[model samples]
Target: MIHFKTLKQANHAFMLLIFILSSLFLSACSGQEQTKQKIPIKDEKTKETAVPLVKEWKMPISISADQGEFYKVIGWLSDQQIFYVTNLKQSSHLYLYNLITGKSKLIYKTENPIVNVQISPSKKYLLIHSSPSSNEGLVTIIDSKGTELLKKTFPSYDLDFEWNPYNESQILVTKFAEDWSFQLNLLDTKDASTTVLHFPEPFIKWINKDEIAYLNWNRNSPSLDAPLSFNGFGTEGEKTVFANIIQFEVYRNMLMTVSANKQDKSMADYSFFDKKLKKLFSFSIPQLSNYSDWLVPFYDYSEGKKQFITFKPLTSGDADTYSEGFQLIRYDLVKGSSEILLGGLENVPLSVSPSGNAALMGNSFEKIIDLNEKKIYDLKRND
Candidate 1:
């Protein structure tokens, strides 16, 4: 005779397995579509073909052109301005386009690809740095009119660079080798004289002109994938553990460090800090997938207004399911509430609008997502 208790236990286990499998199946077959084919609509006025805007100003890229015909938009100065880097017959050039005008103008052209382009806080000057072709990386400082103010060369190869907003002469360059180290250099833009303030590890970061927030790398039993890591300043600063440290934003007398952590297998933790290394508040994501990449942080500083720090995680995935995808999250540090601005797609964070309301990001598939509207703009060239 069969035992009734064992039979009941087997039935319950079978039901649990079915429930788990059904949940996964539904998530995989969700309504999210990843189509790269062109969806055409007739322009009402010109009688030309145009792709339908899912939301206002959505799908900025042309949906019918060949790969080389599409402008590779590299950065966004504001919501209204976009910068594109492209090569014409192997000669690299930079163009700034006014999105409102729908017109593009050449800004600077060089023999090499523009690796990094930075605009000053005042919007008066542009710093253009190109990869090293012969000597060290060359930096050219030019005004808005494309007039070259000064040109200089730094000793090491750099992939990342940022300017000090307060002191235009001071610049920070990231040198990547076996590990990430930074060289803080003070430059005389007139004479191009440079003095380097060497900082150890990948922790060197600029908060403002007078102050720099530095993080000390953990050396004891190092694990790159460790859930927590220590950060401080130059062998003496207060030690803080963070899962992923994106950036440090300074407003008034307070300093804010934005970081994220993977709490468990699925949940993630996001935190912001004050100047005294005190935690103001922490946000968490409970059901996010783990196949995410780099986090891009955007901070806004306006007095008496709620400050927001946005985190955009890069991801990779497939058509049937989200194999990997990035989520854009905005944290209102004052109110301590986190909003998932955009999610459920693959993207690489390019730039955020100066007003902190929108951002422009792209994926390998040539799709751009506007975070503020929660819409996907097909950047795929249609012409």
Candidate 2:
């Protein structure tokens, strides 16, 4: 029942639940800038801009440190804008905040706590999640303009999504239950149509346009490793691609896997493979025993820069007690070089900017890293 090593289950949390839904909230809306909030002068020359009292790098609309931060940043839409989640009153709201303009626009709002918000691979659409109950999941797909495209509810304890790299309109989803029962389906976002894939594995990732790979594990006999298997999208198939692999992820046409070295249990090897599953390269990282059993470090992959990035601790130790912090390391595939982007930070959830120019780190995304300037800025601070 664990997906991608493990999942941190929020205790009986968050939803915008409806049996069936669409166009009901903001029916058939188009993309447009908000006319309310700030009205600029028609004659540009007549408008005067005020000078700032704080550093230019601070958030346009700041949240206080005492409020128990709720906002979780998704990522940067552009250098000046970002998408993040926070609750307003009893309702959860997604906001598009402009760093330069000091404007925050309501993108989406719901009475239920917004469980998750993810942008499409092309950055053209968003996938939002809300669970109405312990066994139900509701998904809302919208455009960058915040216009709702499709919405549906599923009978699931957990719902996982893997967006198709080749087709932004298609998605592979796994609906899970409390008892570890799951159903995998290929979903077409355009029509809300789905094709049920008859596969045994609960976790899967798209290997290519026509094939998908998954960690095939024995339910009856659990182990530290699983067989990496591949199956064609349209065919009923079975093929073991690799063995003794802990985890795998696919970015565009490249496949990456993390497996334990036979000779060393305390170290992990990351292997990169092309579309054909041919090993292109590999590297090693010291593993924290906290990540010892079934976990990996906070990591992200950037296809734009062909880099594998991770928050590596000073040394392999208990992941729970290690306060020495971590180094934000980036391994470049093209140049075969490793660079430390940032250091002296705990291993929190790492979300890199789409342009690879910045990263939001720490609880509530309270810390921001200017990847270009090599500067770290505090988003929320005590005055």
Clashes of 2: 1
Worst 10 residues of 2 by lDDT: 11-20
The best candidate in terms of lDDT = 2
Segments in model 2 whose C-alpha atoms lie over 4 Å from true places:
1-56, 63-69, 290-292, 317-323, 380-383
Worst 10 residues of 1 by lDDT: 33-42
Model 1, which residues run further than 4 Å from truth?
1-71, 132-135, 175-184, 224-267, 276-278, 286-326, 363-372, 379-383
Q: Which lDDT tens digits does candidate 1 get at residues 1-383?
A: 33446667759777778778988887766633322122222234335433233254424543222212443666556556766666554456666666555566778876665666777765677888776563367788887767888887665656456566667766666655434445556565767776665554544445535556554435675432322233322445444444444444455445555444544533335455565558776655433333333233333443334455354444322223545455666666677666776665454544456555445655322454455576656544454
- Which pairs in model 2 have colliding backbones? 289-292
- Tell me how far the alpha carbon of residue 163 in candidate 1 is from the true structure, in angstroms, after superposition: 1.2
**lDDT of the candidates, in the order given:** 0.54, 0.75
Alpha carbon deviation, residue 332, candidate 2 (Å): 1.9
